[model samples]
Target: MNQAIDAIRTFNRFFTRHVGAIDARFLDTDANLPEARLLFEIARLGPVLANVLQAELGLDRGYLSRMIARFEERGWVARDRLDSDARARPIRLTQAGQAAFEEIDGRQRDAVAHDLESLSATERDDLVQALTRARLLLDRQAPDAFTIRDARVGEVSQVAARQSVLYAESHSWGHGLEVVEAETTAAFLRNSDAERERCWVADLGGVMAGAVFLTDEGEGTARLRLLHVEPFARRRGIGDALVAGCLDFAREKGYRQVVLWTHTVLEAARRIYARNGFECIDTQVHHTFGEPVQGETWRVLL
Candidate 1:
């Protein structure tokens, strides 16, 4: 326990120093760290309740009230009482506040770029994986505790990256997997049909825990693509939920049937597909990922 505490403290100290290197004075914009924090938080989740903000950041109520008042005085924020609860008020960034946030955000990005500009691609990947593991451990998020939502801009590539990393680590799949996933994902976005297809991501604690894509395959048939969940985030019914969501969307889109291709080795996913009414229609051995694997095609009548 002492060693774990010491390790955590060491990381905390290192992070503090890292931020100090980034900008100790909030990029010299007259705002201290706390104020900068408040500004950025408000900017992202503005129109958010003060109590919610305080709770999310673990800020003292009194301290948060003071900082909010300061922002209001600077014409950077405004608060409006909630109709449901008079004591509850939501804070929002004013136009001036938004401009300030943009400036601060831009500066922060530039500072980060300048700070880590020397790292190679491999080093950056290492750092990101380290950070992801740290977050997954520290947040202690439950496997099923995730929100299924529409895949947003720039997240498709992230989905590909997540799949790449996980597959490489777990299955020893080569770069070919990432290449196919990336190309298919990009094409999914480029040629998305609003009425016929959809993409859903399992957003676990703001991280991409899993993702599933449904694409139109013409002839009243829809194809389910890229169905996967992070290993750490498995077994919480996320996979089932994602598959169900895709099926529901397909039904809503008037598809007569749905089909999916899966590797036989993916037992968990196979179970999910089976539970969701899919039946294996065909199978073939392929050396797609530089190894011979049995791939199965499953189909279900909608």
Candidate 2:
């Protein structure tokens, strides 16, 4: 523990001193850190909605409004109304602001890269690899950002049809996947919501890619069921996102833990759950789904 604490402190000191983040530039000028950060964000994601910036940065509406006003006074930014929403406004960096931001951006990157280059090539590669691994691990452990929204009417039928087709092809288990008609799924979806059972469908580019549901498990716990990502979206991290979203919703609804039951044949899902801190607590032989399969129960404390 002492070694770990020391390593973290050393890294923090190194980052602050050598990273040349926007905060450092604030000191060089008389400007403050918040303003500098706002400028940088605008330069990077300008033509972005104001509300998006507020959520992403966790800035107060009043503070952001004042900052934008300041930028506008200096002709450093411009605001335009969103076409889809008349009341919504998006900000963009003006020509002068873009040029100024570009110069600062180059300096910031160069400073960080130069410090990193102080290390040997082999050392740099190893450090990058370690950081990448740490990020992947952190993402698995962290709370998911996806929110639980109301599923549109009849969304379950679409998801079930998608899931049935997938299971039929992927698992040798049985025609059971083909046997469970859409009516069963439609009933489940219609009865579930944010309060009782959480159900969600992932929509990208205005199309539903996947869906998952967590029904009441009794005793302050919930069971994650019906995790299905469409074939086209299977490898795109959608499954992990769905699982994380379900767990997050479970926590929000005052659950103490979340559990899942799945066949051992689904190695990918198992790994995702395990990485997110789920542990197998039970197993059994099941003849359901028309296949003799070994089912495992996994759980994670909220």
Runs of candidate 1 with Cα error greater than 4 angstroms are 1-10, 15-133, 138-144
Q: Relative to the unseen true structure, what is the Cα RMSD of model 1?
A: 9.0
Question: Backbone clashes in each candidate structure, one number apiece?
Answer: 0, 0
- Report the lDDT tens digits of candidate 2 across residue range 35-111: 76787888778788888888878999999999889888888889888778898778999997787677666765776
Consecutive 10-residue window with the lowest summed lDDT within model 1: 136-145
lDDT of each: 0.85, 0.74
Q: Give a tens-digit lDDT track for model 1, residues 242-273.
A: 99999999999899999999999988889999
True-structure lDDT of candidate 1: 0.85
lDDT of 2 at 181: 42
lDDT of 1 at 33: 75
RMSD of each: 9.0, 17.4
